[model samples]
Target: MTASTAQDAVTAGFIVIGDEILSGRTKDTNTGFLADYLTAIGIDLSEVRVVPDETDRIVEAVNALRERYTYVFTSGGIGPTHDDITADSIAAAFGVTIDVDPRARAILEAHYPPGGLTAARLRMARIPAGADLIDNPVSKAPGFRIGNVHVMAGVPSIMQAMVDAIAPTLKTGRKMLSRHVDADIPESRLAERIGEIQAKFPETLIGSYPRTSDGRFTTQIVIRARDEDILEQATAAVQDAVSITLA
Candidate 1:
């Protein structure tokens, strides 16, 4: 699916692929990075799914997410190792053939020394048919974008670089605006009023984050909305709620 217009809300889904992530062997940081990146670029990250290296699971998540969101991004299964089955799974998800792309091979060749492009290294050149290459400046091994899905390396630096490469081509929407109101009280004291405010401002999202400092409890109310006026109103309401509760 293509990106929606500026007036429409463009949404995205993220798929984190790797068995290590599920086994607690690797901590995932890409999800938070991508969420921030997409939000900054005006694309709402609507969903995120962490799946193992199994081809079926990858294909299932890819197909489901691709059909649901404006764009789908996948990270962690496009490497040169045998466990890197993201390319094959993406091809299967789209019912297309996948083979070594000459352009990608040329890029890898230029990066590697003479005869350095071994069979394992060549695996990085295997891209799905009708996909466009996403440049990875960190390493020469490029990522590929097929339809609305972008497959990038599992490495954080490379994935971030790939995001930069594809950022310019993406269609962005109205940026979401947010305001934070801190209350020197616990969430339990403000929960009812915050819920009432949330119901009153249906167009805005109100979230309460609670924290403890020096044996004292406090809450941070974050109000998010596309409209500045609505955000300001909701933020003011939350502040008033906090003040009234404190008084």
Candidate 2:
């Protein structure tokens, strides 16, 4: 995905790679962040998968997603420790050789002290063949981009930095718009009406989520679409139905 060209639609998938995430030892935040970010930029976050630190699993997941989506992002398992197998796994997926690139090594060398760039720390410099580095501003240890797959750090701060760095370079489509209307009634009261409204505007996605306020029952009807006219029509219909029920 390049910055110059706009597409009719753009789609993305995310792979959260870590054993700690599956083990419940670490909570996953990257998926939610990517979902919201992609939507804001007019890209559909169509799918997501979580895989462990195992190289084979990561390779399989990466290959599948990269082929399916316009872009695939993987977060986690790219650290200096022994278990950080993401780079190796991603390289294996692309049938590339993994080696410490001089550019990456230089960055790490500059970040650490004269003698602090140990063999373990140098592991962060490994890049798959023909891949470009994704700038990591928070920590100097950079992430990398291979083909349509971007490999990022697991830490939220570092990951966010990487995302910001790459956001401007991605192609985008028309942004999806959304709005919500509140009803002073339970979801059951609006259920049938919602079905009718949805049927009327099949192009728009309508959903009802019940909410409680000050001991009163209510439902929040959310309507989303790229077409503002259709969205407005659905919103008005929903409001009228709720008002009539109250009357």
Candidate 3:
């Protein structure tokens, strides 16, 4: 669904590309970081996708998500490795040629001289036309941005630094408000009561997270809303329904 670009709401989507991730060899860390960071900055993460390192797949995902969401962030497969085809796929998605962009080349040349610029390293400089370079503080090889997609390194630390660098450029909306209350109750017993409270507070979203560790059933009911008053009301209703005093 297309999210409203109103003054109070922001929407974002993420694209993760790599064969390692698709094959379950590498667990994704960027998505959780992006979700938490963007939520704190008032950008709702509407969708996330993980695709294999294939040109056609990447191009299709980029085109679809870029048009659907206000901002799109991609991680993985931008390195100097042989399977790193993110830049070319991104160029194809935007219907442009992959070339040694002067700005990108200048950025790289300052770090790696002509003789030092191997084919693998030069692969990082081949950005699409009219794209801006994203600063990667962890590595000399920079990520590039085109349209709504902000491409970054797959490594967690580097991706986080890139995110910090680009956050200021985005127009963030009002932050989404949230409240949570935990109780030592089972989900099967709490589900009906929680449903009742949710129906009463239509604007608030209620979620029940049940965890059974150490042979104890612990449940957490979280209330999420765009409005503070509604969140407060829903939280109170949940507490009342569950018969626990929330701290």
Candidate 4:
């Protein structure tokens, strides 16, 4: 299968591999980062899965998610350690051979100079055939594109950098925009009217987030749509329902 993104409503998924993540050693900031960034660029994140360092689990998640989404991004397990098996797992998932590619090797060699291409470092050079290279400014070790999946580092800064390098090449959709307003009224008081506004503005998404703190219930309503005009209209209706204005 090939990796494909659309000029409209591009749906994407993510695979995060690391025993550390599953064991709660590191709380994931990558998912939130990617979610906000991708949404701004018009790619909707459909799903995210965090798996262990096990190759079989990684392979399965990669294969399944890639086929179901327009694009798949994997983070973590691309280091020089023995447990960094993302590349090999991805290769196995696609039923492709895992070996150091000349292009990737050349790139690594260019970065590392004389003794830079050590065995451990060379392991980073193994990429699936016909994959594209993703620039890694943090370290010269590159991320590879196989099918529709872009595999990058687990480190937040490096992953963010890698995303910046490749995002321009993606086909993005019209960005979904939103506006929010908070009211001290209970959500139950606005439930019926909120539902009515949602029905009237079917193209827009209306969400009511309610929280109880101390002794009062507060609600925040968010209106979202690909079309700014529709989003504004929904926002107006929401304000009318709650009889509250937002500055």
Candidate 5:
């Protein structure tokens, strides 16, 4: 899992756990950042789930995602508050014991002044047994990686720092290449041709996004593929399809 092979396609799943996000009290910005970051590193983000800060919900999402994807990243519920149950939930999902990790405690101890690491703050040091710690440069409270699951902080800054810390350690696949062609035509008019083009290039992904410009409908056809030559062929086919539709 640490090295990329020709046949390997690295994929990731993301879980956002927080009741505040579900209630719209806190906006979740980590998903988009993670998606972009993973994509840039040649890891496809296959799925994303936003679950409330409930232990069962978190466990369910973690188990489901960890089983399906090459890697699973969880953000939120790792804080020191009463509702922060991600560490315990992850332990439950993996059927492992969770306790204050000495390494994490040491890191926190160094970050916090004497007696500042209160009982509540000590919660941040808890980590599932047999897990590796992910460095959190923004904050001293470290994230943990258990199995394929990486449990990170909910805060955007801290989560971003954790991602940076873990980026170099992750395996990456062939980078996905993309090309887009904007056409001055309605999507419906090019749907059939696009379908034909898609069938011709089964290895490539073709998507059509429609929008309005000056009250006129237009479409942007985007083609993606791991192989650059295939991507170019698919994009050319899409362009031809758009031109034919216009004709």
Candidate 6:
């Protein structure tokens, strides 16, 4: 099945664009934020890809993901430097002309003084031909949504603002409910039984995370499902399989 056409009815893809993230010069904290945000709001963040500040790669990844998911959110490469090529790459990906958007320009102009709006800063005003802007309250430079894709700033705070701005525009599905069980048994000991529970409850997603603290190895089993009853069933199955306390 295609990425968008997968079992989940509501899904999203994330594209992290920047050489900094690829080179490990800047740690990527936005992806996790997006995942948590999307998950909380009933959207599954199903796919994620990190690309450098290369135009062709950005264009390729954007095109592929836009076709594959219900929505594609791109972070980074929308800054005011020579390396901020996301806007141009996205325009190329949609086969549209890139030009200074008057609306975006107005926002940037309002944010910066006349002399402060340098040519480099104006670069953030460039938007694809057919797209609506996603507001950025943190930094006046706005992000835009084209087709199924929503582009946003790479900075954690700004990207989060853009996401909030775009949330109302999306078609959200049923919210996913999560239950975490702190199991006294080690992950290896409960692996087989958890596999059985997963097979028995196919609609829910179950994951076991192991951690060792104070020389004790324990596992945290997380159960996620849209239906509370099903989530309870999954939780009960895991609890019956091993000794666990609700978290």
Best by TM-score: 5
lDDT per residue (tens digit) for residues 51-78 in model 2: 9889889999999999998999999988
Q: What is the Cα-based lDDT of residue 37 in candidate 3?
A: 99
Off by over 4 Å in 2: 1-7, 214-216
Query: What lDDT does model 1 reach?
Result: 0.93
Model 3, range 1-247, lDDT digits (tens) per residue? 1133244677788999999998888899889999999999999899999999999999999999999888999999888888999998999999988888777777778897568888778888888888999997777678888999999889899999999999999988878889998888777778988988888877667899999968988899889888888789889888887784332
The per-residue C-alpha lDDT of model 3 at residue 47 equals 96
Q: Which sections of candidate 6 miss by over 4 Å? A: 1-8, 243-247
Worst 10 residues of 3 by lDDT: 1-10
lDDT by residue for model 5 over 124-213, one digit each (tens)? Answer: 999999999999988789999999999999999999999999999899988888999999988999999998988988777789999999
TM-score of 6: 0.90
Q: Provide the TM-score for each candidate, comma-separated.
A: 0.95, 0.90, 0.90, 0.90, 0.97, 0.90
lDDT of 5: 0.91
Positional deviation of residue 30's Cα in model 3 after best superposition, in angstroms: 1.3
CA deviation > 4 Å runs, candidate 3 = 1-7, 244-247
- Give the Å shift of residue 183 in candidate 5: 0.6
lDDT of 6 by residue, 1-247 (tens): 2233244458899999988998899999999999999988889898999998899999999999999889999999999998898999999999999899999999998999769999999999999999999999998999999999999999999999899999988887778888988887679988988999999988788999998877999899999887789889999888888853323
Error of 2 at 14 (Å): 1.3
For candidate 5, the per-residue lDDT at 155 reads 96
For candidate 4, the per-residue lDDT at 224 reads 79
Tens digits of lDDT, candidate 4, 4-62: 21335788999989999989999899999999999989898989999999998998899
The deviation in Å at residue 170 for candidate 5 is: 0.6
In order, how many clashes per candidate?
0, 0, 0, 1, 0, 1
Question: Candidate 6 — number of clashing residue pairs?
Answer: 1
